[model samples]
Target: MLRGVTHHITATREDGTVFEVSYGYGARQRRLLACLHCDWEEQITYGGTRHKGLDHLAQAHGAVGNPTMTADARARRQVLWTMAICFLISAVILWWATSRT
Candidate 1:
Protein backbone atom coordinates (compact mmCIF):
# COMPACT_ATOMS: atom_id res chain seq x y z
CA MET A 1 0.00 0.00 0.00
CA LEU A 2 2.96 2.36 0.22
CA ARG A 3 3.46 4.40 -2.91
CA GLY A 4 5.82 2.74 -5.44
CA VAL A 5 6.49 -0.22 -3.14
CA THR A 6 3.92 -2.77 -4.27
CA HIS A 7 2.80 -4.07 -7.67
CA HIS A 8 -0.84 -5.04 -8.08
CA ILE A 9 -2.38 -7.50 -10.52
CA THR A 10 -6.10 -7.99 -10.93
CA ALA A 11 -8.15 -10.46 -12.93
CA THR A 12 -11.91 -10.61 -13.31
CA ARG A 13 -13.85 -13.71 -14.19
CA GLU A 14 -16.83 -13.90 -16.58
CA ASP A 15 -19.22 -13.64 -13.69
CA GLY A 16 -17.47 -10.46 -12.46
CA THR A 17 -15.57 -12.09 -9.65
CA VAL A 18 -12.43 -10.14 -8.85
CA PHE A 19 -9.09 -11.54 -7.73
CA GLU A 20 -6.26 -9.31 -6.67
CA VAL A 21 -2.61 -10.23 -6.39
CA SER A 22 0.05 -7.99 -4.91
CA TYR A 23 3.83 -8.34 -4.96
CA GLY A 24 6.20 -6.49 -2.73
CA TYR A 25 9.31 -6.65 -0.61
CA GLY A 26 8.54 -7.71 2.90
CA ALA A 27 10.90 -7.86 5.85
CA ARG A 28 14.55 -8.58 4.97
CA GLN A 29 13.79 -7.89 1.29
CA ARG A 30 11.93 -11.15 0.94
CA ARG A 31 9.33 -11.25 -1.84
CA LEU A 32 5.69 -11.65 -0.82
CA LEU A 33 2.40 -12.34 -2.57
CA ALA A 34 -1.00 -11.36 -1.13
CA CYS A 35 -4.53 -11.93 -2.26
CA LEU A 36 -7.20 -9.36 -1.57
CA HIS A 37 -10.20 -11.63 -1.96
CA CYS A 38 -9.35 -14.13 0.73
CA ASP A 39 -6.82 -15.07 3.40
CA TRP A 40 -4.11 -16.18 0.97
CA GLU A 41 -0.78 -14.54 1.44
CA GLU A 42 2.59 -16.22 0.92
CA GLN A 43 6.24 -15.59 0.33
CA ILE A 44 7.44 -15.95 -3.23
CA THR A 45 10.23 -18.41 -2.59
CA TYR A 46 10.62 -19.40 -6.30
CA GLY A 47 9.41 -18.87 -9.86
CA GLY A 48 8.40 -15.62 -11.57
CA THR A 49 5.72 -13.22 -10.30
CA ARG A 50 3.49 -13.44 -13.34
CA HIS A 51 3.35 -17.20 -13.28
CA LYS A 52 2.26 -17.19 -9.69
CA GLY A 53 -0.33 -14.48 -10.33
CA LEU A 54 -1.82 -16.24 -13.32
CA ASP A 55 -1.94 -19.59 -11.58
CA HIS A 56 -3.68 -18.06 -8.62
CA LEU A 57 -6.23 -16.45 -10.87
CA ALA A 58 -6.97 -19.70 -12.65
CA GLN A 59 -7.22 -21.83 -9.56
CA ALA A 60 -9.23 -19.39 -7.50
CA HIS A 61 -11.45 -17.56 -9.91
CA GLY A 62 -11.24 -19.59 -13.15
CA ALA A 63 -10.02 -16.51 -14.99
CA VAL A 64 -7.09 -16.27 -17.38
CA GLY A 65 -5.08 -14.08 -19.79
CA ASN A 66 -2.86 -12.21 -17.42
CA PRO A 67 0.38 -11.71 -19.37
CA THR A 68 3.64 -12.94 -17.98
CA MET A 69 5.53 -10.00 -16.48
CA THR A 70 9.08 -9.78 -15.23
CA ALA A 71 11.30 -7.35 -13.43
CA ASP A 72 13.39 -4.93 -15.46
CA ALA A 73 16.38 -6.82 -16.87
CA ARG A 74 18.43 -3.66 -17.32
CA ALA A 75 18.08 -2.79 -13.66
CA ARG A 76 19.04 -6.30 -12.63
CA ARG A 77 22.13 -6.20 -14.81
CA GLN A 78 23.13 -2.87 -13.34
CA VAL A 79 22.91 -4.24 -9.83
CA LEU A 80 25.03 -7.25 -10.78
CA TRP A 81 27.69 -5.04 -12.29
CA THR A 82 27.80 -2.86 -9.20
CA MET A 83 28.33 -5.90 -6.97
CA ALA A 84 31.10 -7.17 -9.24
CA ILE A 85 32.87 -3.83 -9.11
CA CYS A 86 32.73 -3.77 -5.32
CA PHE A 87 34.14 -7.29 -5.15
CA LEU A 88 36.99 -6.39 -7.50
CA ILE A 89 37.91 -3.36 -5.41
CA SER A 90 37.94 -5.42 -2.21
CA ALA A 91 40.13 -8.06 -3.85
CA VAL A 92 42.63 -5.46 -5.02
CA ILE A 93 42.86 -3.94 -1.54
CA LEU A 94 43.49 -7.35 0.00
CA TRP A 95 46.15 -8.18 -2.61
CA TRP A 96 48.00 -4.91 -2.00
CA ALA A 97 48.01 -5.40 1.77
CA THR A 98 49.29 -8.98 1.46
CA SER A 99 52.03 -8.00 -0.97
CA ARG A 100 53.30 -5.31 1.43
CA THR A 101 53.44 -7.68 4.40
Candidate 2:
Protein backbone atom coordinates (compact mmCIF):
# COMPACT_ATOMS: atom_id res chain seq x y z
CA MET A 1 0.00 0.00 0.00
CA LEU A 2 1.11 3.56 -0.67
CA ARG A 3 1.91 5.60 2.40
CA GLY A 4 1.74 9.32 1.87
CA VAL A 5 -0.30 12.19 0.52
CA THR A 6 -1.76 11.46 -2.93
CA HIS A 7 -3.44 13.85 -5.36
CA HIS A 8 -5.20 12.72 -8.52
CA ILE A 9 -5.73 14.52 -11.82
CA THR A 10 -8.08 13.46 -14.59
CA ALA A 11 -8.56 14.66 -18.13
CA THR A 12 -10.71 13.63 -21.05
CA ARG A 13 -9.49 13.51 -24.60
CA GLU A 14 -11.37 14.61 -27.73
CA ASP A 15 -12.57 11.05 -28.17
CA GLY A 16 -14.09 11.06 -24.69
CA THR A 17 -11.40 8.77 -23.35
CA VAL A 18 -10.43 9.70 -19.85
CA PHE A 19 -6.93 9.55 -18.46
CA GLU A 20 -5.75 9.95 -14.90
CA VAL A 21 -2.50 10.81 -13.20
CA SER A 22 -1.41 10.52 -9.63
CA TYR A 23 1.07 12.89 -7.97
CA GLY A 24 2.31 11.90 -4.58
CA TYR A 25 5.08 10.37 -2.51
CA GLY A 26 5.76 6.69 -2.86
CA ALA A 27 6.34 4.23 -0.03
CA ARG A 28 10.02 5.15 0.04
CA GLN A 29 9.20 8.88 0.36
CA ARG A 30 10.13 9.72 -3.22
CA ARG A 31 7.77 12.06 -5.03
CA LEU A 32 6.24 10.49 -8.13
CA LEU A 33 3.98 11.35 -11.02
CA ALA A 34 2.32 8.27 -12.51
CA CYS A 35 -0.24 7.87 -15.24
CA LEU A 36 -3.02 5.35 -14.74
CA HIS A 37 -3.73 4.95 -18.42
CA CYS A 38 -0.22 3.98 -19.45
CA ASP A 39 3.23 2.97 -18.23
CA TRP A 40 4.43 6.57 -17.99
CA GLU A 41 5.91 7.52 -14.64
CA GLU A 42 8.33 10.13 -13.39
CA GLN A 43 10.15 10.61 -10.19
CA ILE A 44 9.62 14.26 -9.27
CA THR A 45 12.81 16.04 -8.27
CA TYR A 46 11.89 19.73 -8.25
CA GLY A 47 8.19 19.96 -7.41
CA GLY A 48 6.64 20.63 -10.82
CA THR A 49 4.67 17.40 -11.03
CA ARG A 50 1.40 19.20 -11.65
CA HIS A 51 2.60 20.90 -14.79
CA LYS A 52 4.40 17.79 -15.94
CA GLY A 53 1.32 15.64 -15.51
CA LEU A 54 -0.86 18.13 -17.34
CA ASP A 55 1.64 18.40 -20.13
CA HIS A 56 1.69 14.65 -20.54
CA LEU A 57 -2.09 14.56 -20.78
CA ALA A 58 -2.22 17.29 -23.38
CA GLN A 59 0.74 16.31 -25.50
CA ALA A 60 0.51 12.56 -25.24
CA HIS A 61 -3.21 11.99 -24.90
CA GLY A 62 -4.59 15.20 -26.46
CA ALA A 63 -6.50 15.92 -23.30
CA VAL A 64 -6.75 19.25 -21.62
CA GLY A 65 -8.55 20.66 -18.60
CA ASN A 66 -8.06 22.27 -15.26
CA PRO A 67 -6.79 19.46 -13.11
CA THR A 68 -8.14 19.30 -9.59
CA MET A 69 -6.74 17.98 -6.36
CA THR A 70 -8.43 15.16 -4.54
CA ALA A 71 -10.94 15.97 -1.82
CA ASP A 72 -8.83 14.29 0.83
CA ALA A 73 -5.80 16.44 0.00
CA ARG A 74 -7.93 19.58 -0.06
CA ALA A 75 -9.47 18.69 3.27
CA ARG A 76 -6.05 18.04 4.73
CA ARG A 77 -4.87 21.45 3.54
CA GLN A 78 -7.95 23.10 5.05
CA VAL A 79 -7.32 21.43 8.36
CA LEU A 80 -3.73 22.60 8.39
CA TRP A 81 -4.81 26.14 7.58
CA THR A 82 -7.40 26.08 10.34
CA MET A 83 -4.89 24.80 12.85
CA ALA A 84 -2.41 27.53 11.91
CA ILE A 85 -5.08 30.20 12.26
CA CYS A 86 -6.13 28.87 15.62
CA PHE A 87 -2.55 28.81 16.79
CA LEU A 88 -2.04 32.41 15.70
CA ILE A 89 -5.21 33.54 17.46
CA SER A 90 -4.26 31.74 20.64
CA ALA A 91 -0.81 33.27 20.60
CA VAL A 92 -2.21 36.75 20.22
CA ILE A 93 -4.65 36.22 23.06
CA LEU A 94 -1.92 34.87 25.31
CA TRP A 95 0.38 37.81 24.55
CA TRP A 96 -2.42 40.31 25.17
CA ALA A 97 -3.33 38.68 28.46
CA THR A 98 0.25 38.56 29.71
CA SER A 99 1.00 42.17 28.72
CA ARG A 100 -2.00 43.42 30.68
CA THR A 101 -0.35 42.50 34.03
Give per-model TM-scores: 0.54, 0.57
Q: Please, what is the whole-model Cα lDDT of each candidate in the order they appear?
A: 0.68, 0.75
Question: Number of the top candidate by TM-score?
Answer: 2
Question: What are the per-residue Cα lDDT tens digits for candidate 1 across 1-101?
Answer: 21224777666578745466778877777888777776666777887776787678778778653464334433444576898899999999999999996
Clashing residue pairs in candidate 2 are none
Candidate 1: regions farther than 4 A off: 1-5, 68-101
Per-model C-alpha RMSD = 15.0, 12.6
lDDT digits (tens) for residues 1-101 of candidate 2: 22465777766678756567887787689888888878888888996777898889898888874646456445555676898899999999999999999
The alpha-carbon deviation from the true structure for residue 58 of candidate 1, after best TM-score superposition, in angstroms, is 1.2
* Candidate achieving the largest lDDT: 2
